[model samples]
Target: MKHENAKYLRPQHLSGLELVRDICCGNLEGGSVGSTEVTLTPGKIKAGNHTADPQTAGSVGLLLQVSLPCALYADGPSELCLKGGTNADMAPQIDYTIKVFKPIVEKFGVHFNCDLRMRGYYPKGGGEVVAKVSPVSELSPVNMTERGTISKIYGRSFVAGVLPYKLAKDMATTATRVIRREIKDLYINIHTLQEKDMACGSGNGIIIIAESSTGCIFAGSALGKKGVYPDKVGFEAAEMLLRNIRHNGCVDEFLQDQLILFMALANGISRIRTGPVTLHTKTAIHVAEQLTQAKFTVTKADDENASNDTYIIECQGVGVTNPHF
Candidate 1:
């Protein structure tokens, strides 16, 4: 299938390892996957209700992340019902996405409302989320050159099913202790939630969010695994947040890549100063450049006061307008 607009071209197809070989050899013809098929006809995106159930116990945050941008192109408001693991390992927790990730994108003019109907964990996947997305005519460029003082830090330490409530309390206490060493006057408020009613399975995790005076937010998290102690999880999350603050970057490490696409769509130039560039950030830059046919530049920070890992990314946006396909 093919979707074409002045801003981008989307070739929707299924592929496997063989498809990689074909692309490497410059063969443009498509390959097949399963019998599942889709037929596309040219038309404006219509407002409607959509349901997605990713049968696997994969992270619902991953599914929502991929689908949110597409929803913004709809001609009218869109409502989505998603089901899967709400707090699975190796993916951004749903709480972080809603509180941290969504707000960052909102700075660029994306509008959406989400509610977690039920919490899902690993091994048994039955989580439900509802999101309402509104279409936008255009996205604004974001200039986050400075991340001012860290005014406050807040977090949630939650446990569900069989875990003891003390686990969550201990996590909050441990994390607060670690953060106070760096910022003597810092206000760290960690809430503890131990609920047997909301979760689909047994799990515990902590999500920390740091708010800057300039409205930039940096978040860090740690999940509890089978053998990991609750205190260790709390300590790790605090350490991660401290590391990001020490680097003096505008956003946390993981968020740098997430903003690339929005930056490419904005009007005029968009610049971001961030910590060490990861492969994910590099890949996002490549993908944005390829899809929008725009230019992005990466430069290392030369200031003696800056950390060696500091880098600056600049991009010339295509000025994606409303009524985009």
Candidate 2:
């Protein structure tokens, strides 16, 4: 769909689908998402190499979020060559999508692998990523009401283009120091890196993650801005992660919404424990309900020791299967 106000977007690639306009949205001067037309073929959308060029610093991660689900039900597998921002200010960072979202989505039985080929920053966007998704005939439901043990804490602080590598190291050092002060007995490792090749524009960002033994993942991230101290960025990211840890939910707030569609499409009942419901999650739930026959319920979790912020999201999926698969 091409809107007057929308930026560029990549079309979903399925075996049986035909498309004239791929995810090539507007130029640097963004536009709205007013779709003019759509065409379809006999099988699922034709799966193959596709590209999404937002021209501006639009999000490649957002492109995947819109297309990956459709690819799962495709006639075959899909390989996407996405180009745009890897670490946008508004969308999920590429790292969070890979590290946190990928694991949780795989639990539903579909699998995909992503490799960042280049680091794309805001304004003049020139990042690239290659993602391969394996088609699944049916999806399995998930159960993750318990947060379980926090097995590990790890992160990465990255700098690219004209950004100094010292900034990355500074962010990592400060974040490690902050987290260690709170939890003393876990393996804490935050790596600092300088993007050596094909890094578009100067940029820096930090991501901190906590992985639960039960497969739940939570994360916090902070982007480096002009005039902001690297140490302050690290402190902010650590604090964001710590706040999620304090929630004690099975999943992070951001993860809550992303799973709604999968839960609605899975084979059985799916349940998860999460922190406060985000507006994005609510919107996803509404969209899922409108598009599928799935039923969803949101209620407070029955844990006396838990804080008031904890809640349970349960979905009765329609057990939809791929007809072409």
Candidate 3:
């Protein structure tokens, strides 16, 4: 079957799963298994919904990461009902996409929403999410230079399917305690969710976010495992967020990498103060510089306590516009 806006479908092998990417002109589609389909339309990328289900449990969050940005330059608004794993090992979860990613992008005029219909976990792979995207004429530059005072910290701990509600509560409580120990007077609120039968597969996870006065956000997350105690999961996530904040970065390490391509595509100078640049960010910068005419520079922060751990990233955008739309 052919899709109107569809461009091509090529098979890919990863983690012992044979899959196909239903790539469109403007964006790359991470499709599920099955197909020799490839067609390229020489025009604007039209919006369309895709299903990546059946036997493969692909990462819906990964799909969104690639899809939403391209959709911003699409011919029109896009709606996607992506199916596969909502929570898996080594990929961003749906909650992170909503709580952390979506809010940060709004600062740059990118608007999108994800409505999760079902929670799909690993192996068994039955998850569904409805995502909506609105095209933008151009992306606005963002500057996050200083690590501002933290206003509040909010968190969510969820257990789905066969997992017990106690696990979710335990995770939330432990995470709250750990964060409180460090912040002292800081207020922390964490909600617990027990997804009984509403989700497709069995799994549990925790996500914690800290919001600063200057609109910067930092987060930590960890997924539940079979033998690992719930408290351990909570502690891991808490430590991750704490480490991120202690580095005195305007944004977390992961966000630094996530913003790389967006910075390159933006209209003007985009500056971000972040903790030590990760190898991921390094690779992303290299690829963006190679692909687009965007120029990027990295320099150490000038703070009295600044060491190799803190640095500033600046990007001069190529000013790519949505003329096709």
Candidate 4:
């Protein structure tokens, strides 16, 4: 019902449960979640622009995550605009969500796009993000296990507000250096951005995206915090991406859970090989099972010839239909 992370990002006076209650049930006369028991009545969802302001520097990425499913089933196209932290600690970055996450969802026959109007960091929190989601009548099953060949590696480094452009460049340089050691012929390009008009205040970070010949794109990113060196941020981001690459997973660690809900909603069985199963993945499976009549199985492959044990997630979908039959 409540979590430490939720407590940190939510308004200090409002509990996470209370916030959800207010949003879903609407607060009448300042009544809290406990004031009344509201039953959710299902109906044909409307298509239009929906917006929210988290009030805290909460990750807009997370907000989008919860909204995506509902949007996908809307009677018509839906658009969402969220104002909050576009990039924050322990949350998915807008770049990764756009480049890596959305593409994976597309494989399930869901079409959507994310556009970041302005970057938002912590403290000042003034970022804006817009998402356009197209309704889907059905979802397709996926069976991805190969990572294919390394084709190109590129990155984007951004510094907002008062940060120097050199910080972004340095982070890209450091990250490229570490990644080059793994694949000598790999081409690493880094784009540096120093924008004075950051909607969400000041911050610096880098995101490295690896594109494979099979069209699978994986990403790793690091956000700049007080006292952290730019070079270190680059190195860490590079290392994270490299680790994911070495694992030979079709989907990166952070993406495994994100794909689960779609897989469970698909029309047929879906399977994928990924890195070690994370608690987040398990939790997603649990939630998916509860939401739909879907079944999930996780298996760990033990092969003496393989460097690391791989995780396999298999899902039998509930065949959820769009526009509600």
Candidate 5:
């Protein structure tokens, strides 16, 4: 007697199995992994040939929906191992790496029996992939100094992570332009957040060497979430220094305090007017007042507006044998 007609799997059933196998093997390219617009549709299968095991047959007709997480990396496609999934009220779990996808997997090969340390969780997604990246190259050394003459170097820094690249570049450019315009024969260097990691604020400093006839002044302005413009602040500071050098007048009171301290160290009597003092005639009157308590006798030039109204207060102190003519 011939055996009863054996059951044969149909084309449709074979196709369904192939589809599931393809997804499991990562054979299908869902979409651009980094694209925010891409989405994936789950596969479904219809009922077909049945076997004694209802479990395998029962799953044949059910639809399997696999939703993927959005890719966030901007660089190239990254290899990720899905840890596990959460089913509504189910607690989170991890997924073991069985096999890796091809091309990428072919190059990197498969990694089994590997431990994935979860540092943080991507909410809702059950599975997580950890990748080991290559180390970055070492940074080159940099040396900063004032060339020949004393230079006032000012630097303003912003958090690079917080600001866009273009905005940071623009801020640096604006600051340099303002500094060069205010100070003649001045050199300005502007660095970005990547260059300097100081907190977001502007700084102004001046440097003067005894050998150099002129002093160098610098002002740095920075862009912050909120505050005055750093470029303008730097400009104001440089301009203030320039005005002091040109007019021989006290543009900022801070300089007066510095002058007093500096001259005291040299044991040279220095006079800075507390009230409104011009570069014209009355500057001598101001210097005479400062010398009243001191032993040195103050003398003023008799000629009016002599040598651009520069009044030299001759301090006849013990160490100061010759007065500053």
Candidate 6:
């Protein structure tokens, strides 16, 4: 008698998973694991009021397993696996996996260790699997001023489909124009993914970051299908950075020249500029209010005649406050 080979093919990279991780983790500089497995089994399919009758009646099913590297999860492993009675619903399974992982990777500091043990087929079949998890250090804090060093801008917008490249470019141009002086050394990146349109536009999200003389700034924006103007997304992000700067009382000719120093202190400081004020000026009372919840000191200039002419802000939790928590 002759035996047949099972033909075990290796799993390929899942772009969906990578995209989710990138969106969540901000930058791909954090710690990660490699070559984790994911297994799936088949389950009964309901037909209207009752379970669907099997045509053959004999055991009929399929199994699926995938292997991929851990992209995010600085603290421990995050599980990625099939759900919803994993029968033939590949699309739903994938969607659930993306939803579960996206927010987890973005909000928390955990790693992933996926494992696929058994496989299942359609028409009432089932199996079991496991995913290992571990923890790593939290990602480094990021700021917004880093945009000064960027050169090119990349923009990606996901509506029902990919928005026109021209539209994305227009948004990028607007962003640059709004903050031209603030973002020269940074590169802008934009991409649109259909996966983001999965359900009532709940999956839609935007991310913005900049690399400056100091370091990097990571920011993100998300929108549902039924709310807000999409065109304002990038502009809003730019404004947020501006507000953060103004709220911090760090907007001054001197501070701008010495951005590296302030950038280093951004994680430690809370309040920034009130608008586009300069350094060495009396800090604004608003700065005190804003930094009240942060970790930096709020400083203001006492003399109204000083040539520095900078606004004042506060840093609520410098050296002691940890944004990660």
Task: Give the number of the best model, judged by lDDT.
Answer: 2
Residues 1-325, candidate 6: write the lDDT tens digits: 1112243222112222232333243322221224234222222211111111122111111111211122222223344332212212221122223222322232223344434333222332232233444433332222322123333333343332233334444445455555556655555555654432222212233434332233323232323233445557557645544443333322322233222222222334433332344443234323423433333333444433222433434442322222223
Residues 49-109, model 1: lDDT tens digits: 7666655456677666666666676677878777777877878888888988899899889
Specify the highest-TM-score model's number.
4
User: On TM-score, who's better, 3 or 6?
Assistant: 3
Give the TM-score comparing model 1 with the true structure, all chains together. Answer: 0.85
Please give the RMSD to the true structure for each candidate, in Å. 6.7, 4.7, 5.2, 3.7, 32.8, 19.1
C-alpha lDDT score of every prediction, in listed order: 0.77, 0.80, 0.78, 0.78, 0.28, 0.32
TM-score of each: 0.85, 0.87, 0.86, 0.88, 0.29, 0.32
Residues 1-325 of candidate 5: C-alpha lDDT, one tens digit per residue: 0111134443223333333333333232323222223222433221121111111111111111111111111122222232322111111112101111111111211122323432112122222233322211111111111113334444433333233455445555655565567555655554455412321222221111111123222211222324545455434534543443432322122222222211222233433222123343244334433633323232333443232423333332222111211
- The candidate, 1 or 2, that scores higher on TM-score is 2
Please give, for residues 99-199, the per-residue lDDT of candidate 3 as tens digits.
Answer: 88789888888998888998888777788888888888999998988777888899889998877999999999999989988898887888899886768
lDDT of 4 by residue, 1-325 (tens): 2222322323412332332333334332322322333233334555678776756677778777877877777777888887678878898988889889988889998888877888788975678888898888989999886667879899899898888889999999999899989889977898988877645588999999998888777888999999999999999999999987886768888999999999999999998878888899999999889879799998875544234657778999998887553
lDDT, candidate 2, 175-270, per-residue tens: 989998888899789989998686899899999999988888999899999999999999999988888877679888778888999999999999
Which residue pairs collide in model 4, if any?
126-199, 126-200
- Please tell me which model should have the higher TM-score, number 1 or number 3: 3
- The 10-residue segment with the lowest total lDDT in model 4: 1-10
